[model samples]
Every structure is written in structure tokens, then in C-alpha cells.
Target: MSKIRVAVFGCGAIAQRRHIPEYASNPNVELVAFADPNKQRAEEVAAEYGGKAYENYEDILKNEKLDAVSVCTPNYLHAPMTIAAANAGLHVLVEKPMAVTAEEGEQMIEAAAKNNVYLMVGHNQRLMPPHVKAKEILESGRLGRVLTFRTSFGHPGPEGWSLDGRDSWFFRKDEALMGAMGDLGVHKSDFIRYLLNDEVVEVAGFIGTIHKEDTDVDDNATCIVRMKSGAIGTLMASWTHYKGGDNGTVLWCENGVVKIGTGQGDEVIVELTNGTVETYKVGAMATNEKQVPSGVIDDFVQSIITKTPPTISGEEGLRSLKVILGAFESQDTGSIVKL
Candidate 1:
């Protein structure tokens, strides 16, 4: 079969670090074009990775012979870009928090459906090997029914992660929308939902901007969720953990507790009520400076080649996004929100 002609939209940190490199490595993909409002970034990526660069993303859709494109733009732009790319008959691998608004997410999902293209979201936490193993254990009923859980993803902030440092779009409400909730909390929501095979039914949350100076978006966000199975969980996303970053989850279950991303290695530790502890080594989580492709890109390419649906479909992204946006509503009202 011929390679899937691919272009990358938005030449930001994610595009340069993940999408571009991963697609370059995938034998099934042919790098055709790159685009960003900042023509320099796109030109740089194209120079290193072999592609034509365009300042206007529309040019890629109009000119490139592409089967897929990864949408690595800011949060607010995800829906429009995904919709446009899908409408162009190109499969899309979009960043997480699929859209800033659930309504936008729905529109993106509908666009993909109408255009007959695959739309995948970059909730890469689920691709962490331990997370994959955790899902397996939960699905096998090895941990019994989930009772409650706590999951968190925290780090110093995008100042350390984004290419533009503190001046990055991530700090602006006009650009990135909400901060940690959209950035990390949404990822955790999706991760927990996948790990438990359940959906968030309700949310109670607190969103704040206690850390970053001159930043309008929330730097910290915490939410409690009730799952469809009557399981309750706490989800947290923070960009002010000055001490150290922790990305992990602990699930208390009827038979035992599933501890994920815990300890030295990327291990999922299962502790039974009977005091039996079993640890499974999956793989290490990626960091900003030392990131590798999170398997999302690989899965996307394979799904296209096999004529299969993406595992993290646009609808899947919407469900997770609902929890985050619902968290915002809960925070605003200081009450519970039913998803």
C-alpha cells in the first residue's frame, strides 16, 4: 500500500516534538507539508523534516495531497482546524480537550462524521504502558468493582514546557482558554474514564489562579466526579507543583486498589485487601524536554492503514472534555454539575 500522505498543522512544541518526529519515523506516512500562522516555525519544521511550509493552514488543505494532519494549535482553535481538515477529507489527530467548548467538540465530531474521516484526540496518558496495563487489569475484573479513585497530573507550568515560555498562549484566556483544567485535568479525566471503563456522571470542582503571576487562566484545578457505575473519583491538574511533578492514579476497589504510575519504575501496583501486592512494569511517562511519541501517532497511522476507527475517537474526546467543562461550571456555581 502507498504511504499515507500527511501534513502537520501548527508548528508549535507538540508539532515539533511529537507529531513531526513520529510521523517522520512512521514508514506509512509521507511528510508533504507544514503550516502555522508563524511561517518561521513551519518553515523550520519543514526544513528539518522535509515538507513545504505555509503560513496559512488552509493552503495545506487546498494544495497538499494529504490523508491525515495533526492539529497542534492552541486550545480554542482545535475545533475549527479539525472541522476544516476533516471537511477536506483528511484524518485528524488533534490535541486533547478536543475543543474549548463541548458544543465545538460536537461540531468537530459531526464534521468528521460527515466528511468520513478519522478524528483522534491526543489524550496520551492512556498510552502510557502502565495505564494500558491498568485498563487491562480493570477490564479483567482483577481489581473487582471500582469504589473510588484519585488521579493527578501536575508540573511547574507551561512556562517550562511551551516553546514560548511564560509568554506562551497557554497563559492567556483568549488563546488557551482555561489553564490546568483544559491542559492536564482533561487528560486525567479521559485517563480515569478509560481505566475504569466508566463515564463521569457529575462533577464538583474548584478552579483557581493561585500560582502564575500575570496569568488570567487557572493554574490549579481540582474536581470530584461520580462515575456512571456509582464510583466516585477525584481529579486534579496543577501547574504550580514547585516541588516535583506527579502523574499518577490510585483506584480503590472492592477487592483491592490499583495504584498506577507509582514508585520508581512506571509500575502499576495492585494491592489486594488480603495484603497481596503485585507490581507490573509498563513504561516510563514522557517529559516535555525528553518526550517520545506517545503511541498515539502510531495508533493513528495504523488505524488509517487498516481502515479502522481511531481508539481515541472524536466522540471519546468529547466525553472527557465534558468533564473538564463541567468542572468549570461546577466551579462557577460552587455546586455539583451533572454531565
Candidate 2:
């Protein structure tokens, strides 16, 4: 079988540092080309990976015999790029949060379905070993019924992480669509949904730009959710959690509770009503062991070969986006928004 040809549509830090290396080393994939609006950055990444560089992403879509493309562009570009790739008959692996809005995410899903191509979202947290174990544990029914939960993802604002520091789209409402909620809250929202196997039906939230200056979006946000299953949750997502403590998921259930974090390799720690604390560890993809990001990329490639839907499909991505948007709506109205 011919290795699946892959092209990355952004030479930003994420593409160059993670996606390119993962694709270049995957046995079943060939790193074929790259595209970026910035010519020099695109050329640099392309040269580093032994691939061709195109200033315009359309160039790669029009010419390469690519089986898939990783839409590694910024938050706003995610929808357009994924839709284009799908319409061109290429499987799309979009970076997290799906897109800025549920409507946009729906369009991406529609395009993929219309063209008969796969559309997967890169919610890499779902691919992490610890998170994997947590999901399995919850599914095993050992925790009984979940009553409430809390999850978070944060880092000192994306100053160094983004292409431009404070001036980046991350701080701009027009480009990012939402602040911390879209950036990190959605990951937790997805994790919670996956863990509980429920759709969030209502939300009450507080969204604000508490820390950053001259930013149009929130730097800090908090939300309380009511799931369809009647379980409730409190979530905090911010770019200001630079103090860094136990930053992961915690579920409170009728039987006991489950705590997930990086301290135990992101393992799931379960405490039962019987006063027993058990830990379960989820293993990583061997070739990319010790590296969590590769698991997502590897799965994306495997989905293309197996003609399977990725664990985080485009529809699932939209569900996650809906949660985030609900939080925003809740914030705007200062009332519980029902899904």
C-alpha cells in the first residue's frame, strides 16, 4: 500500500514543532508539502522536512496528490481551510476547538460529508494517555453515576506560543471569536462531555478580560454547566493560571471520584466509597511513546488508512464548540443558556 501523502497548511509553531515531525516519522505517511501565508516560514519548515513550500495553501490543495491535510492555521482560519480540504476530497485533521462557531463547524462537517472525506478535529487532550484512561474508567461503570465535575486548561497567555505576542489574534475578538473559552475552555468542555457521555444542556458563565490589557477578549472565564443527564459541573479556563497547580479533570460520582493530572503521567486516580484509591495508566502509541501529541497525529493517519472516523470527528468537534459558545451566550445574557 502506498503511504498516505500528507500536507500541513500552516508553518506556525504547532505545524513546524509537532505536526511536521510526527508526519515525517510516521511509517504510513509521507510528509509531502507545506503552506503558509508567510513565505519564509513556510519555506523554512518545508526545507526542514524535505517537502515543497507554497505561500498560498490553495497551491498545495490544487497540486498535491494528498490523502489528507492538517489544518494547523489560527482559530479563525480553521473553518475555511478544513472546508476547502474536504471539498477537494482530502481528509481534514483540524486543530482544536473546531472553529469559531457551531455554524462554521457545521459547514466543515457538511463539506466533508458532501465530498466523502474524513473530517477529524485535533482535540489532542482526548488522545493523551491519562485522558484515555480516564475515559475508559468512566465507561467501565466503576464510578457509578457522575454528579458533578471540574476541568481546566491554562497557560500564561499565548504570548510566546502565538506567532505574535499580545498583538496576536488570540487577544482580538474579531479573529479569535471568543477568548479563554474558545482557546482552552472548549478542551475541558469536550473532555467533560466525553467523560460523562452527556451533552451539556445549559450553562451560566462569567467571561472577562481580567488580566490582559488592550485585549478585546476574555483572559479569564468561569462556567457552571447542567448536562442532559442531570449532572452539573463547574469549569474554569484562563490564560492567567500561570501559577500552575493541579490542572486537569476531576469528576465527582456517586461511588467515588476520579482525578486526572500530569503528576501520575496523567493517570486516572479513582477513590471509591470503600476507602480504596486506585490508579489506572493508559499506554501511549509505542513509536511515539512519552509524547502525547503524536498519538493524535498517528490516529489521524490511521483513520485515513482504515477509512474510520477519528475518535474526535467533526460532529464531535461541533458539540464541543457548542459548549463553548453556550458559555459565551451565558456570559452575554447573564443567565443560564439552554442548549
Candidate 3:
């Protein structure tokens, strides 16, 4: 089998940390091209990873013969890049918060379907080891039904992580669309939905730029969500956790509770009504401070090889994105918005 030729559309923090490295590590993939507005960044990535660097992504799409492309650009560019890639007959693996709006997400999906190519979204939280184990436990019916839960993803902003530091496009509303919610909240929303095997039906939340200075986008967001299965929970995202980061989730179930990404040593801790306690050292989660193999790149490659839809397909991405959009609408109207 020929190696899947791949291009990365952004050479920023995410591309350098996750997409580029993962794609390079995949034996079945070839790093063929890189595109970024920063010519130096793109050239550096290309020099290190073996690819042609392009100042414009359109050049790569029009000129490169590639099997797939990773759309690791800003939130605003996800839709356009994916659409163009799909139209070019290349499979797309797009980063999270799939697009700025539901309509854009739908268009991306349509383009992929029309072109008969895979469209995968980078909702990698579901693939986290602890979260995977938690889902297994929930599916085993050991925790009965999840009644309510709380999940959060927070850190001391993206300044330290982004390549551009504090001035990164993440802080700009025009580029990021929604700040903390788009960056972190969407991950939690998709995660909870995946864990419960349910969909968010309604959402109400408070989102604002609480601490970050001179940023129009929200630095923090807290939402109450009602799932279609009648499960209710709070979803929180913040870029103002000065001390450290939190990617913890606690589920209150009918029979007991499942705690994930909380314990110091154990990645998952379960306490049952029958007094049975189980602790799992599944693995460490990928954080802004620590980089881990997300399993997303491998999955994307395998899906193309096997000619199957990605686990996190475009439709699934759209579903998860709608939850974030609903929260934003909720914030705007000060009322519960239905998904």
C-alpha cells in the first residue's frame, strides 16, 4: 500500500505539537507539504518534517497531489480549508470547534460528502485513555444512569502555549469567534456527549472575558446543559486558571459515581453504591503543558486506508459544534437555547 501523502495547513502550536509529529510518526503517512501565513514557521516545519512550505494553502491544494490534509489553522479558516480540500478530492482532518457557525459546519460536511472523501474532526478528548475507560464503565451499566455531571477544561490562557503567545489569534473574536468556549468548552461538550452516548438538547450559560485583558472573546464560560436522555450537568471552560489546569469530570450516576482525570495517580476512580472502589492508571491526558499521542492522527490515516468513515465524522462534529453554538445563543439571549 502506498503511504498516504499528507499536508498540514498550519504550522502553529497545534501543528507543531500534535498534527505534524503524529503524522510523521505514522508509518503509512508521508509529510508532503505545509502551509502557513508565517513563511518562516512553515519553512521551518517543512525543513524538519520533509515538505514544501507554502505561504498560501490554496497553492498546496491546487498544486500538491495529496491524499489528505490536516486543517490546523485558525477557527475561521477551518470551514473554508476543509471545503476546499474536500473539493480537491482530499480527505480532511480538521481541528475542533469545527467551524465558527453551524451553517459553516454543514457546508463543510456537504462538500466532503459531495466529493466522497472523509471529513474527520479533531475532538480528541473522547480518545483520551481515562475518558475511554469511563465510557466503558458507563456502558457496562455498572454506574446505572448518569443523572448529573460536571466537566471542566481550564488553564492559564493560551499565551504560553500558542506560537504567537498572548497576541495569538485565539484572543481575537474575528479569528477565534469564541474564546474559551471554542478552545476548551467545545472539547468538554463533545466529551460529555460521547461519554453519555447522548446529545445535548438544551443549554444555558454565562460566558464572558472575566480576567484576560484587552480580549473581546470570553476567557471563561460556565453552562448548564440538558441531554436528550434527561441528563443534566455543568460544563465549564476557562483560560484564567492562574495556578494550573483542570481536565476533570465527575459523573453522578444512579448507582454510584465515576470520576475521571481527577486523581493524582489514578486516571479514573470509581465508587459504587455497593462500596466497590476501582482505580485505573489508564494514562495521562494531553494537556497544553504536556504533549501526548492523541490517537487522532492514526485513526484518520486508518480510516482513509480502510475506506471507512472516521469515528469523529463531520456529522458528529456538527452535532458537537451545535452544543457550543447553543451555549453562545444562550449567553446572548440569557435563556435556554434548544439544540
Best by TM-score: 3
Query: What is the Å distance of residue 204 in model 1 from its true position?
Result: 0.4
Q: Residue 134: error of model 3 in Å?
A: 0.5
How would you encode candidate 3's per-residue C-alpha lDDT over 1-339 as one tens digit per residue? 899999999899999999999999999999999999999999999999898999999999888999999999899999999999999999999999999999999999999999999999999998988999999999999789899999999999899999999999999889998999999999999999899999999999899998889989999999999999999999999999988579999999999988998877238999999999999998888888788899999999999999989989999989988999999898899899988
If the candidates were sorted by their lDDT against the true structure, best first, what order would they fall in? Answer: 3, 1, 2
On a 0 to 1 TM-score scale, where does candidate 1 land against the true structure?
Answer: 0.98
Poorest lDDT segment (10 consecutive residues) of candidate 2: 284-293
> Candidate 1: lDDT of 91?
92
lDDT of each: 0.90, 0.82, 0.93
Per-model clash counts, in order, read 0, 0, 0
Alpha-carbon deviation at 154 in model 2, angstroms:
1.7
TM-score of 3: 0.99
lDDT string for model 2 (168-283, tens) is 77777777777878878888888788877899999888989998888878888889999999999898888886666335778899999988884454567899999998977666
Show model 3 residue runs off by greater than 4 Å. none
Q: Which pairs of residues collide in candidate 1?
A: none
Candidates sorted by TM-score, best first: 3, 1, 2
Residues 84-130, model 1: lDDT tens digits: 99999989999988999889999999999999999999989888888
